[model samples]
Target: MNRTSNPGDNQTGTSQRPFRVTEDELERALRETLAGRVAAPQPLAADPAAVALRRARRSGRRRALSGLALAGVATVLVTAGMAQLGEPGGNHGTPTVVLGDPRGFSPAPLPTATAPAPGPVRAELDLILGSRLETSGGEQQELTNVGPVERAQRLPDAGGWLMTSATPAGRTLWWLPPNGSPPQVLLAGADAVAVAANGRQVAWRDGPDLHAAGLVGGQLIAANQTPAPAGAEPVGFAGDAVLIRQPGRGGFATWSRSAGARPGPTAPNVLAVYGELPDGRVVGLVAAGKPGRPCVALLDPARDLSPVRTGCGPELAVDGLGAISWDQRWLLLNGAGKAALLIDLRTLGTTVTAHPAGPPVVAGVAWTQTGVAMHVDATGGLVRVRPDRVLDGERPTASTIDGVAPADRPVVVADAGA
Candidate 1:
C-alpha cells in the first residue's frame, strides 16, 4: 500500500509550521524559557510594591523597543506604497436605528474578545499638565503661564494649543503657542458650557449663544443663539460644523453649525450626540437594544439618525460628556470600579482597563495612536497601557505625567507625524 504525505509534515516527521508562532508568542516563549532557567517572577500578592516597580521598569523597556520597531515598519510601509491605516476595524454597511421604536431592536452584547497580539507601541503623544506638555522623549516645555487651567487641546499644524484657564475674572479661553509667547485671550465667560475645535477653527458655547473662530485670529465665522428649551446644549464642533441638542417632539432634534442653529429633522430615542468624524460621519449615544444600556452610534448628519454600529455595551456611560480618540476611532465611556470602557469605531469592539485598586476614580483618560493614558484621582497617578494588553487584563505602567491635580481629563496631543 502507498501512503500519502501531508503538506504540514516533513520527511523527518517534523511540522513545517512549528506551531505557527506569532511575534508575541515567540517573545513570551523566550521569556518563559529564561525564567525557567533562572527563577520565576514574584506574584503580585507576595510583594505588591516590588512587583509594580519591576513591572514598570520592564514595561518602559518594552515600550521603547516597540516604538523603535514601529518606526522601522512605518518607514518600510511608506517605501512600499501602502497607506497606513489609522485604526484597525471595519466599516462595511449602513445600519439603521429606528427613530422611536423599541420593539424588534436587539443589540449585540459587549464582546469578550481578547486583544489580538500587540505590535510595537508608538510613542508619539505629549501628556499635557498644568505646568507644560511633556513629550515621551523626556522633553518638557512651559508653553503657557496660565493659572489653574481647566482644559487643553492641541491645535492642528502645531500652530498652538487652545486651553480654558481660570482667572480671577472668570473662566477664559486662550491660545498659547509652543514658543511661550503671551497667551491670546479667545473668550472670557463664567465657564465653557461646551467647547470643541478642529486645528483651523474653535467653537465654544457660553450662556445661550455658540461661538466659532479661526485659530490664528479672525472675526467670528458663526454665532448660534439657542432659545430656552427644557434641555438644550451644544454637543461639540464637528470640523467646521457645531452640533446642538434639542428636546424631543417626536424623537429629538439636533442642530448643525452650518445650519445656523436651526433644528434638523427629529430622530427618535437618540440620547446623546458626541461630534463628527473627519469623514463627516456623526457619532452619538443611544439606548442599546437592552433597556438602560447605552451604546455609541455613528449616524449621517445629513440623513436620519441611524446607527452604523451600536455595540458599546453596558459599561459605556458618560459622566458628563463622552471622550473620543483624536483619530475618531475610539470612544471612552465611564465604567464601574473606576474603570473606563474603550470602544473601537471600526470594529465596535469594547475593552475595560482601570486602576487595580479601583477607588480614586478615573479623573481623566485619553487615547493616542497606540495606547491610552489614565489618571486616577485617588492615587494622583498617571498610567499608560497598551489597549490590547488592557483587554488582556495587564496592569498599566506608571506614566511620566504625575503629581498634577487635573481639573478635568487631560488630552493627548499627537505630533504631526504621529
Candidate 2:
C-alpha cells in the first residue's frame, strides 16, 4: 500500500495496512547487498577484550553504513541534536523496558488500528530559537526572535507552545488550540516558561544558577532557582536537574542540579557517553578490559542499574514505557533511517513499512513526544505514529503550513532531508 508521505504537516490517517518485511542483515550480507563489495567482515574472537573491541568497531561501522542508507529512509526517524523519556513496572515506572539486540533476526507483525475522525489536531513543539516546524492538524510555528531560549522548549503533552522568550514587550507565548481555533499567547518573563500539562513551571538561569517558577491553575507562584556551580556553565535541565559541562582536573566534567541544590555526580566522565531512556534511566557505556574502561552500563536512578537491560543495542535510547520503535518492535539498525540501521534483538519480530518520503541519509536521531523523528540530511520532516493505531507519518496537502498563516514562518529543525 502506498503509505502517504508528508513530513511537512502534523499527523493524520488512512486505512491501516499490514507491515512489510524488512529484516536486519548481518554485517557480511549487508556489505555484499547494500554496498555490493567484498570487504571482509571482522571476526569476533571469543575473549572478552576481543569481543569488546569488535563491538566498538561494529558500532563505528554501523554509523558509517547507516549514512549510505539514510537517504531512502531518513524521514522515518528523528535525531539526538542533543536533547534526550516514560513509565515503569516499578520504580523504573510501570512499563516493560528491554535492551534487545538490534542485529539478531526477529520478525513481528506491525500493529494497526483506525484513527478517529478530525485526526490529530495540534501538537506542542520542543524547539530552539531559529528553528522552524509545523504540526499535522494544520498548525505552524516559528521562532521569530533571538531571545534567551537555551533553556526554553515545548512540552509534548501541552497545547500551547511553551516559551521563556518572554520580555516586557507584552510578548506572548502562543498555543495553537485544537478545533481549528486561533492561537493564544501568554505573557512570559525573563526566566519564565510553561509546560502545557503542568502549566507554567518556568525555569531560568542566572550566570551558572538555574531557577523555576510557575502558574498553578491560574495563580502565579514565585519560582525557585537552582544555583550553578562555581565555575561551570549551565548546559540544560531535565525536570529539576541542571546539566553543566565543564573542564575538569583531567578531562571534561558533567554536573547536574535539581531544585536549588549544588551539583553532584562530579565525575570527569563526559555526559555524551550516556543514554537517557524514557523511564529516566541513565545508560552509561563502559568498554570492557580497561579498568573504568567504558562498556555500555545501564543506570536507572529510580531503580538500581543492576535490573536494567544490558548490552543489546547498548548505545541506543532503549525505552521502558512503550515499544522500541513505531511498530512496537526492535528496529533493524540502532535507528530507522538509512544511515543508522534499526535492528531488533527480540525474537523474530521484524517489519518494513514503506516510507515514501524519508531522507537521503540518516546519522543521529532526536525523539520528540509525539513520535520518534529522524535526522536525515535532505528534507527534514516528522513521522507521527499513533501507538496502537498505526505507525504513519504526516504531511499537508494544500501547501498549508500545518495551519499557520502565511505570515507564520516555521524553520526546519528535524528534516528527513537535511
Candidate 3:
C-alpha cells in the first residue's frame, strides 16, 4: 500500500493521504503469502497422491487469501474501479470493465438475449440478527424467537428459513418455520449446507459424509448420507445434485443420492468455482498470464468443462465471494477490494458491470423474482440492482429500502426467491 500527498498538505500541516494498492502489488503479496502457507506437510509424503493433494491444498489457500485481501480493500478498489468504468467509452454500452492496462487477448462475442426483459418484482429484506423483516409494503415486523444466526437462507415457497448457529459441540443447523414456531434442529455438527434452487432439496457436509434430504412440512425427509472426499464443501445445487469443491481436485464434483459422488468437469487454470446453472453448466474464475490475471468463464459441463464463453478484465480479478441469480441470468462477485462485479450471464460472458459494494457480501446476495437485491458495505442499507435497468444502459445505483434501517451484519432479502 502507498499513499499520495495532497498539494496543499504543507499549508494544512497534514501528512496523511489516501492509500492505494495496485493490482500488480496485490498479486505479488498474494503469491508470496501462498508460497509460505501452502507448503506441503511432510507427513503426507507416504500417500500415493501426495503431489496432487498438495496442489489442491495450495489452490484452496490461494482462494482463501485472495478473498481476505479483497475484503480488506473493497471500498477503496470499488471507488477507483467505478470511476474508471464511468469514463467515456467505458462500460456505457461496451460489455467489459477493464482496469489499468488492457491485455491483448480478446474473446469472441456471444449471442445476446432473445427473450423479453424481466420486470421488477416486490422484494423484502430480512435483518437476520436484527430479527426484523422489511416488508414489500415498507413496514417492519418482528421475526420472533430467531436467535443469533451466523448463516441463513429462506426456504422455497415461504416454507420458512434454514439457519446455522454455533453450539458448544460445533455448528447446528435449524429449521425455522414461517408460522412463528420455534426453530427445530435439522442437523448437528453440520459444516457447509446447500439448498436447492426450488427449495425442495437440501444437502450438507457433516464430518466425513455428505447428507441430503427433501424438505417436507418444514422437516428434512428421505434423509440420506454418503461418504465424501476429505475437505469437501458443498458450494451450490446443480438441479438434483450437490456441487462440491474437493481439496486436491482439479475442478468441481457433483454428489447425488442415487449416483454417489464423482468429478463432473474442471479446468487446469480455474481458481474458484462460484455457482452452477440450472442445466448443470458451471461458472468460475480462471487465472492467466505471468502474474495470474483472472477472467470469468461460463463452462459447459457436458463438454468436459470447456468454456462456452469467456470475458477478461481488471474487474474480473476478485476474491471469489460470488453468487449467481436464481434465474441464471446474472452473477454478483466481489471485486478485489475495489468494487463488486456484476456479470450479465445472458451475454454468456461479455458484459460485466461494476458496483462499489465492497466485499464479503453480508449474508450472500438475494435474487427477486425479476431482479437482484443485497446489502453492500459502501451503502449501509439494502441495495437493489435490476437486470433490465442495467441492460438498458443505466448505471446501477443503490437506494435504501423504505422503512429499513442500515444493518451492520447479515441482512438479506426474505421472500425474494434468492
Candidate 2 per-residue lDDT, tens place, 60-142, comes to: 88866765455324333222211121223323212222223336636464444557545322433333313343453344454
Writing each residue's lDDT as its tens digit, candidate 1 over 111-210 gives: 5557686432224556566566666566666745666665665666556666667777667776776575767776777434345545555555566555
Q: Could you give candidate 3's per-residue lDDT for residues 196-304 as a string of tens digits? A: 6566777888888888888887788887777877788776666666766766534566666664555454455666666777667788876655677677887665565
Clashing pairs for model 3 are: 56-248, 73-337, 74-337, 77-338, 78-338, 78-339
C-alpha TM-score for every candidate = 0.55, 0.38, 0.58
What candidate 3 gets wrong by more than 4 Å, as runs, is 1-123, 133-146, 247-251, 259-268, 288-291, 302-306, 349-363, 378-380, 387-408, 414-418
Compared with the true structure, model 1 gives a TM-score of 0.55
Candidate number achieving the greatest TM-score relative to the actual structure = 3
lDDT on C-alpha atoms for all candidate structures: 0.55, 0.37, 0.63
User: What is the Cα-based lDDT of residue 283 in candidate 3?
Assistant: 82
- Candidate 2 deviant stretches above 4 angstroms: 1-133, 140-158, 163-203, 214-222, 230-240, 247-260, 273-280, 283-296, 302-338, 341-418
| Ranking of predictions according to TM-score | 3, 1, 2
